[model samples]
Target: MSKAKKSIEVEITEKKAGNGKTVSEVYIGKQFLGNVREDDNKFLMTTAKNESFKVNSFDEGIQELIKEFHLHH
Candidate 1:
């Protein structure tokens, strides 16, 4: 018999914020993962753990966050 390993899946959503800027929110199985926002051509992201970081690219934030959580093997 073989056991199935659990995998991590993240959901990403991009929407216009009230400031009229693009905001991307990440969620993992209904749990708030993190959010990345665009400001003055820079990207700022805050993790669900309240850890804030600056990223040059929008996707970098969530990708790093996932790595931080050790979600991928």
Candidate 2:
């Protein structure tokens, strides 16, 4: 069997939330994964699956997304 290649793309943009706060949007390919925002010097990741995670850094947020979506580098 052959292996399949996965492509995970992230678009970091300033998107205004309902509370008027800016958050970065994360996407896996063309699918909307979740949002990552900063709070108290920590990053908060909210996934599309309604899962939330408090990560230390922005990169960590991406890692969490990868794990959540079962994707790889």
Candidate 3:
């Protein structure tokens, strides 16, 4: 018998905010994860629960959201 391999997948999409700036939307499966926006030279990440974080890069923003999701779930 063969065992099934399980993996975690994340999706990111670029969206236009009301102010006409681009933001990255993160999703885990079908659930909405968070949004990462570039402000000055730092990336601002905001979770679905409205929690916020300031990161250095887009990848860091996504990592923060994933950490929050794992902590909560």
lDDT of each: 0.82, 0.80, 0.91
By descending lDDT, how would the candidates be arranged?
Answer: 3, 1, 2
TM-score of each: 0.73, 0.73, 0.86
What lDDT, from 0 to 1, does candidate 3 have?
Answer: 0.91
Q: What is the per-residue lDDT of model 1 for residues 1-73, given as tens digits with 9 covering 90 to 100?
A: 8989988789998989888888898887887778999878888998878888999988788787776666632
Better of 1 and 3 by TM-score: 3
Q: Write one digit per residue (lDDT tens) for candidate 2, span 1-73.
A: 9889866566655688788777888875677778888887889999987788899998898778768777533
Error of 1 at 16 (Å): 2.3
Better of 2 and 3 by TM-score: 3
Angstrom error of the Cα, residue 60, model 1: value is: 1.1
Backbone clashes in model 1, listed as residue pairs: none
Cα RMSDs, all models: 3.4, 3.2, 2.7
Off by over 4 Å in 2: 1-7, 71-73
lDDT of 3 by residue, 1-73 (tens): 9989868899999999999989999898999999999998889999998888889998888888998888988
Best candidate (score: TM-score): 3
The window of 10 residues in a row where model 1 has the poorest summed lDDT is 64-73
